[model samples]
Target: MDGSAYGDIVAQPNWTRSTHDSKWAGYLKSSAPDNTSRRLAVYRGSPLYSRLDHHTMSRAQLLKLALPLVKTHGFTREALSRSVLYLPGTPHAEPLSETAISALFGDGDNARRTLLDAWLDDARTDMKSAPSPIMKDVLASRLRRNEPILRWLPEAFGLLISPPSGVPPLDPSPALKHVASIADEACHIVGDTSLGLSWYARRASVAAVYGAAELHQLASPATAYEFLESLLSSSSNIENTLVNTEAYAKYIGRSWAGIIKSSGVF
Candidate 1:
């Protein structure tokens, strides 16, 4: 975990914490808006992770440090290596070996994937902190965060949907999970306390809308908010349809199972 090195970095100017033992952890907590902290408390799945050990803390700092380099280095190991220089007087400092980068972040695509997760999670949290209760405004806040790295988003998206095997036929789970998290945060922000099947349906609809709006944003950032509004307007129909279909499917499946059991087909 390089605990000693993390301690040294914590001692650096601009990172000292008078209130908490872990300076960097305190810094991260204080930096987020009060609303964000509340939302994070309600949804432990939110990106403001709680396990703040030296390893986790160091990686968080490293990702933040490396984010800017993405503009120049295109989410490559070179950027991560360069970011090490900023953490001077540490075991993770400059001349970062490939092994160190691999240890800090996994090797190959997984490492860049981690970087993408950090970027998206931060954006999602920022979206939750928007003052507006309107879903479209919240989504817009999130999409706008991409502007700084918009030029490279296609590559990031590619990394996101890319299969871990590095083969053709993209895996959508990573992207799906990302959107689902965004939807969950949005629902929390808007005070949507839906439960049962409705909870799943609501989040599914929000995720679908946000996902489409995000893709639209990539092509036409100027009109993305309008597209998001249109999607939101139609979401009720989609949610109703999904809920009915889901309910019907469950009923039919259970009835068939009951019939089969009664018939002693086995």
Candidate 2:
């Protein structure tokens, strides 16, 4: 369910606007005039439901579309409850509110990570299914993973603990090899040196060492050691805490351990 689906809707906008008298599920049915051009229509709209404009999909339609995804994505009341994806309840059970569902989904790392992996997989699948004969290039694959991780890991790992919803910040450790791997791969995908350079400049300014250098054990050991010495020097302030945070620690400790373990470099 994406651009193509929306395109089909837009190709024929025959949806009747919701009048909000009774909460009935909405729909879009296509009656092809010549198999090439069809008149598709939507029905049973609700005031409580939000409408998708690209192709006039009603809340009922969206919920139905999400049914399969929800089922595949561990359909706890969490996602639907938050309205991230609409899920409706009729005259029988108490509807789960957004706040309650969000609280549940954001409950713990295990839950969040499980959700994260699921999202990454979904995004990956959608991207791979692009109509433009999606390329399986390394960069595309990396970006698929990177975008989601950067968008979610900060909160999941408690990096950007109070980040805004949907666009979470990256609080990942600089030493995390996967961070460098993904970033590099994403940059390679865009094939734009300027953006890549800009990205490196931004990450390196505050980071003790950037992802790539640290991950492949290329951290200019001498330079990094010198920088660390300077960082640890006479800074009896919160500034000290900033440089030695979770991301940096994970990069140096866990990520390094992983790389070493993987390479049999023990």
TM-score of each: 0.69, 0.25
lDDT of 2 by residue, 1-266 (tens): 34444444333212122222112222322111121111122232432224334224433233333233333343334434433233222222544464544454444343334344333333333333233331224323323333323433333335323233434454344224334433443334435354433455423332322233222223233353344334323232433354446458768898778888999877
Cα misplacement distance, residue 248 of candidate 2 (Å)? 40
In model 1, how large is the Cα lDDT of residue 70? 73
Cα lDDT tens digits, model 1, 1-266, are 44454454444322322223243333343222223334324434433335334444555566666666676777777877777665422634355678878888788877787777666755665675676977778877888877767778888888889887867678888889989988998898888988889999999999999999989988998898899999999998988898899889999999999999999998
Candidate 1 global lDDT: 0.70
RMSD of each: 8.6, 18.5
Q: Would you list the C-alpha lDDT of every candidate in the order shown? A: 0.70, 0.35
Using TM-score as the measure, the top candidate is 1
